[model samples]
Target: MEDQRIVNNEDYAVVLIDGVCHLCQGLTQFIIRRDPAGAFRFASLQSEIGQELLRQGGFDGESTETMILIENGKYYTRSTGALRIARRLRFPWSLSYALILIPPVLRNLVYRWVAKNRYRWFGRSNECMVPTPEIRRRFLS
Candidate 1:
């Protein structure tokens, strides 16, 4: 699928995450809650569209080492992506974007640790999350 088919650059940002990771799914839910305006859309890293997006971003589609945020025609990965997502969230949550000043090399060190151990700590789903009917529009097929 084409990027435009999933998200219009001016209308929404796309978050690509590990489909079966419990933590990743929870993070999506968290963002949805904080973003009443629904500025973000989601897809699993394992999905075809996600792979295509990854390829377009010059990444290996099979790499699920970090979450990705596609916004304003650019792609950010690791802590930078997380911080950029936070910057778009509501009030107190948006404050987390301040952490961006910490330097990505330092920030990503923590992000990588959590990502590497997420499945062991938070467990995993047998399949990708199926969005509930209420939020179905926020997810890409």
Candidate 2:
């Protein structure tokens, strides 16, 4: 599958994250910090751009159950998406890709646990966050 991986230079990567989830917000920020070159762009799963991408990618646009990564056109979700994001990030975090060896079912179990309780643990925003001006360029309005 790696052989089929398309470099995302021409097509900016878009990450669809749950808008109100604090954990999702933090993860987006983490990716932004680790990706200074701006290799990735972000959208709230509820946003128009995000919904359009989800529909185009053959996903149920309203489902906020998992993080989605759209790269070059193809989309990845769940644990696969997280691992792929990690692969594009800087060192230490990039090391997370090694977890992909554990099998997706197992990896996703942990991811789902966190996502299921994210609101309880991390709280949530009443609306999608407004990006600070410095990072506004990375968000797909």
Candidate 3:
């Protein structure tokens, strides 16, 4: 059997996303495309790892509405998490980190608005999309 790897708070960034949301899955695909260096790892909010992390971070899984980025033991939610992930991405994609300059309040307002309607606007998936064999290692199922 493959050994289970325990995530170290400092070495990896854990992305918490909705396992059944189409928009969330698309965003995960987008990140995978841009993160060619294997800089990020993903976990569905419905997964075991995702649940553990959310509990550790004091997040209520039932009401989670934003993606979470956990880095170096700290957690960033909403736009902050999105921007942090962008910052770690490769070249042109990393440019999106610049959005950090916008005030948090403003950024979060936009993020929350989109999050609120994401299900209605983008729909939900019956299950998380399966990653290709090549990139499967990056996902924490």
Candidate 4:
């Protein structure tokens, strides 16, 4: 609820993630490293702002297992969101967007399986990730 006005603008895309999941945190870091232009911003699914964004995008705010990308007023979820994000990344990493050509039903099957096991295989933090001083500005409070 920290003033949702900022999210309405199309200045950048927003990535909503399971902040406590180690894999999700790593993916955020991965995007940051590859995106020097800072075209993406982030929010933890449990945060007030995140839930608001989720609700605005017509998704279930309570579901944290799925990754969501909000761009230009449209929202992409699950594997589609992940691939769309990859499409904006640098070079070879951006090439991963090609996977989007596969059917969503097939792609999401793998995504769902990994999401189900992520907490067990990668472990999660008791609290959401705290962005570093250098990257803190990129996170929505």
Candidate 5:
């Protein structure tokens, strides 16, 4: 599975997230629910593939506590990452892309505030999220 995840970079989008973060895990699940076209692939930041991707993108894996979107060889982080994912989701949820109009500094201010206290506010999981068998193939970790 790890080998499969390490293939040559392609056109698909990959989401890299903190494996034990409850909020991040929940956001992954939310994306799965809304990504009916299977437009995304996922990996925990702790996974080998996740680490490799971050390295290739020149990002510090340990320092990236927020969700990350890797698309067409570019990486998007913080609120930008979230909005990119949201724009690809189905139906009404894609409407969330409208929030992109807000200044990135303002958006990231709120994002960083939530992220700083995410573990205390949303808690953590001892293990990474386990996708249902039907959707397990979509996850790389």
Candidate 6:
């Protein structure tokens, strides 16, 4: 197991995703690609660091269907997390934040559907993603 790594309450955001889900890995890569400024760190939802962040945010840390964003001691989940993270990205991606005006119930319905089918549709990794040497520091252990 990776060590129990902890993220500090800094300006940087921390994202938690299902480690084995292909869609999640792709999303993480997309974030890294779009955010050249290195504004976020990442951990698997099954990781100790991810659990700690969930607990700190008052969530039970068992649900893995939702993306999570931890920033400045606050946490956002589901569509909110997705949109908030998008707001930090570049170009057309940042435009996604405008969707926040949509009702969350409708948005989360779509999110949950995609999340539920992700592994089936996109496959899964046997283990968490291994960040490349240059980006390794942006991933929590």
lDDT of each structure? 0.90, 0.84, 0.84, 0.90, 0.84, 0.86
- Candidate 4 residue-wise lDDT, 1-141, digit = tens: 333565565778899999999999999999999998998999999998888888777778788979888887788989999999999999999999999999999999999999999999999999999999999999998
TM-score for candidate 5, please give it. Answer: 0.89
Distance from true position, residue 115, model 6, in Å?
0.8
**lDDT digits (tens) for residues 32-120 of candidate 2:** 99998888988888997777767767788677989998887678889999999999898988999999899899999998998889999
User: What's model 1's overall lDDT?
Assistant: 0.90
Model 5: runs farther than 4 Å from truth?
Answer: 1-11
Give the per-residue lDDT of model 6 (tens digit) for 1-141: 222233455758889999988899999999999999999989888998778777776778786888888877677889999999999999999999999999999999999899889989999989988889988988887
lDDT score at residue 30, model 3, on the 0-100 scale:
92
Ranking of all predicted structures according to lDDT, beginning with the best and ending with the worst: 1, 4, 6, 2, 5, 3
Q: Write the per-residue lDDT of candidate 1 for residues 29-112, one digit (tens) a residue.
A: 999999999999999999988888888889997878899998877889999999999999999989999999998889989999
Q: How does residue 50 of candidate 5 score in lDDT?
A: 82
- Which model is ahead, 2 or 5, in terms of lDDT? 2
- Native-to-model Cα distance after best TM-score fit, residue 121 in candidate 2, in Å: 0.8
lDDT of 6: 0.86
Per-residue error for 87 in candidate 1, Å, reads 0.8
lDDT of 5: 0.84
Over 1-141, each residue of candidate 3 has an lDDT whose tens digit, in order, gives: 211233454556788899898999999999999887777888888887788878777888774599988776678999999999999988887899999999999999999999999999999988877888997998886
CA displacement after TM-score superposition, residue 87 of candidate 5 (Å) = 0.6
Ten-residue region with minimum lDDT total, candidate 5: 1-10
Cα shift from native, residue 130, model 3 (Å): 2.1
Candidate 4: residue pairs that collide: none
**How high a TM-score does candidate 3 get?**
0.89
Q: Model 4 off-target regions past 4 Å?
A: 1-4
Among all windows of 10 consecutive residues in model 1, the one with the lowest summed lDDT is 1-10
Ten-residue stretch with the least lDDT total in model 6: 1-10
